[model samples]
Target: MITKSDSTTIKSYLEDSSNLHGGHADKVLIPENTAELSSILIECTSKKMPVTISGGGTTTTGSRIPFGGIVVSTEKLNRIISIDKRALSCVVEAGATVDDLQSACGKEGLFYTSHPTEKNAFLGGTIATNASGARSYRYGPTRKAVKRLKMVLATGEIFELRRGEKLFTGRGVSFGLPGGRRIEVALPSYDMPNVKNAAGYFVKDDMDLIDLFIGQEGTLSVITEAELGLELKPPEIRSCFAFFKDEENSWAFAEDLKGKKEWKILSVEYFSENALKLLRRKNPNVPPASRGAIFFEEEGEEGQRYSAADRWLKFIKTRGGSVDDTWVAMNEKDAENFTSFRYAIPEAVNEIVKASGFRKFSTDIAVPGGNFLEMMRFYKDLFRDDGIRNVVFGHIGENHVHANALPVQGAELRRAESICLEFVKKGVSLGGTVSAEHGIGKIKHMYLKEMYGDKGISEMVMVKKALDPGAILGLDNIFPKELLQ
Candidate 1:
């Protein structure tokens, strides 16, 4: 294991994309492979030292920032074990970046559906949070794509789990540790949110054992390697940008577009007036007379692609859009530009927050379709009433919208925090998830109880103790610090 203990080196691993808070650590470890990583974990656990797993340094929830003890970065174990075209799957080290995996798979005529804005993110981090991106509207989250995983316990025991290989029998799960000891973990009796939730441990009456580790936010074990399922590259991908009169109208059109079952929509992304304003600063190609925009992509046969494109053009025009104002990316280069246009929104927001010297107060709330419009309206009114600058965007197709508040002053930051809590409560009350894609790290751990009631939390805590008797892995993440007491 390569370890760094100097103050300068330790500080480099303290912050992430969240910019909400920074962490301090005594040492940092970058292990080359699972064996080296396990040896380090064994020593740390023996001393009851906290271990924070860092993956690509792109986490907005502080999961990558070490609170204390030590930080372990998985940037070195980035290797593609294999890409079996016949099975339509790829095996990779957890540290391999999203872009690396996608590009490698692309060479084999395959596709990786969960392409989040940050292509440099580690696959292990995505699996840790069970990340879902724009294309997830059609492909689902990382949980759906993962076929198998190899994990190492804090005590240096290694275990490999394959999807559907083990099923919960309602009693619990049993496994043999490396040192002649056996560990059996009981399932949490909590009911998970029906929507795209990445809040806490995945639980059900009879769940797959592999699922228990997929979205646990690194609390259960350290994911070392994974085998991910892939899809054949689409024969054709048609992209279009449709600008609407306002935020409400854009989502209204989104509802209608998704309702059309034959569209074969690959992704339906939303951008509010504020988000568009941010993007326009960097790229002037935004359509005129637009308060909001919806960027959508569809995949189908040549005939089907033409048919879908025609239907989209007609729908946008009938909804007050013009054919000339719309932008089409029929080729490869144009398609890449459209992607930059969407990702630019977040990049701009981060820049603004950094310059203003304030913490980011972004809420990752998602409600069911029945309550999506109401939730959007609620968010807009809350920000407006409080006089806070905000931007709304994300996967509106699944009713999951991220309302990001950019506050400059300290008082404004406090109000932004309060509003975030208010909106999260409202989202939960209306059958929504407190977190749609971002997992509850140290910053949002308190909201876990609201997501799952007292009984449910107790069940979850019991499972946590069973798996991590020492609570050394991802200490103080997902669950509040008081839970440790």
Candidate 2:
């Protein structure tokens, strides 16, 4: 293992995409292999030193940011172990990036469907958070793709957990470790919102033993390697940007797509009028009159692609969307452009947050499909009444969207924080999750508490303490470190 104690070199490991500040670390340890990582954890646990697992630094949450700890960087453990074509699965080291995995899978004509929008994200981090992106509308999140994991617990115990190998006996689970040791813990009793979520621990009746570690936000153990399932790539995908004359029309267009099972839509993303304004800064091609837009994709035989486009055009017109101004990607180059357009919104939001010198205040809430419109209206009314600069966009098909509040000044930042709490309460009240994809890191602890009350948090704390007895891993990630004591 290579260790760096120089403060200047370790400074870069102090922050993530969340724009959260004040992270401090005494040093960073780069482990070359899983055994090296295990050794490091063993020593740290004995010393009672806090250790934070460092990934690609692409998290919107401050999960990787160390408050005061020795950072364990997984950068050198970047290796693709194997790709078993027959089994439709690939094994990779923790530091391997999503882009590399996607490229490797692409060469085998396979696809990693749970890839987040950020290509630089590490596979381990994505798995740790149960991340999902646009295609998740149909494919679902990273948890569904995880088939197996090789992890090192806080006590230096290494174990390989495969799907279906062990399951909860009601709200409790037992795992046999090396050297005849066994770790038994009761799973938290919380009814996880039916919507897309990554708030706290993934708790359910008779849950898999592997799933307990999937979204623990690194508080439970360090995932050193993972075996992810893959899907056969479609022959071709048809993606389009359908611009609407009104924001409500865009919502209707998205709702119509969600209701039509025969449409076979792969993703249904949305952009509000304010979001379009941000996009217009980068691409003047955004329809000048468009109040909102929906970016959608579908898969079909190459011969029928044109017919599908025609059908989409007719349906868009019926919903009062702009047929002539619609942007469709029939070729690879066009598809790339359309994908970049969808990603640009988050990039733009990050830029605004950086300039404002405040942490990003964005809601990752998701409600049931039936209550989506009401939630959308609540967002619009609350943000408008507050008079804050904001943007709304994301996976509309999952009834999940990110509402970003951009605060240019200190007062606006305070108000933005208050508004975000209101949004969280409203989301929970509507039977939704406070966090849909982004896991609760150092921030959003209060919002998590809103969804799961004090007793629920205590139940989660029991799971954490049971797994991480030293409380040396991922301090203040899902919950405050004090709770561990």
lDDT per residue as tens, model 1, 1-485: 68889998777688878785658888889999888998988888889888888888777787777777888888888999999999989899989999999899889889888877888889999999999889999999999999999998888888899998887888488866557788787876666778888988887776788898988887788999999999999887888888888877788889987998887788899999988888778878676569988998888775454566677888988777777767777676777788888888778877887787776678888888888888998998988898788888888888998898888788787788889888988998998888889888778865677788777667777777787777788877788645755
Q: What is the C-alpha lDDT of each candidate?
A: 0.83, 0.90
lDDT per residue as tens, model 2, 45-83:
999899999889888888889988799988887898898
**What's the distance in Å from true for residue 377, model 2?**
0.4
Off by over 4 Å in 1: 178-180, 302-308
Candidate 2 lDDT (Cα, 0 to 1)? 0.90
Q: How far does residue 370 in candidate 2 sit from its true spot (Å)?
A: 0.9
lDDT of 1: 0.83
Query: Worst ten-residue run, lDDT, model 1?
Result: 301-310
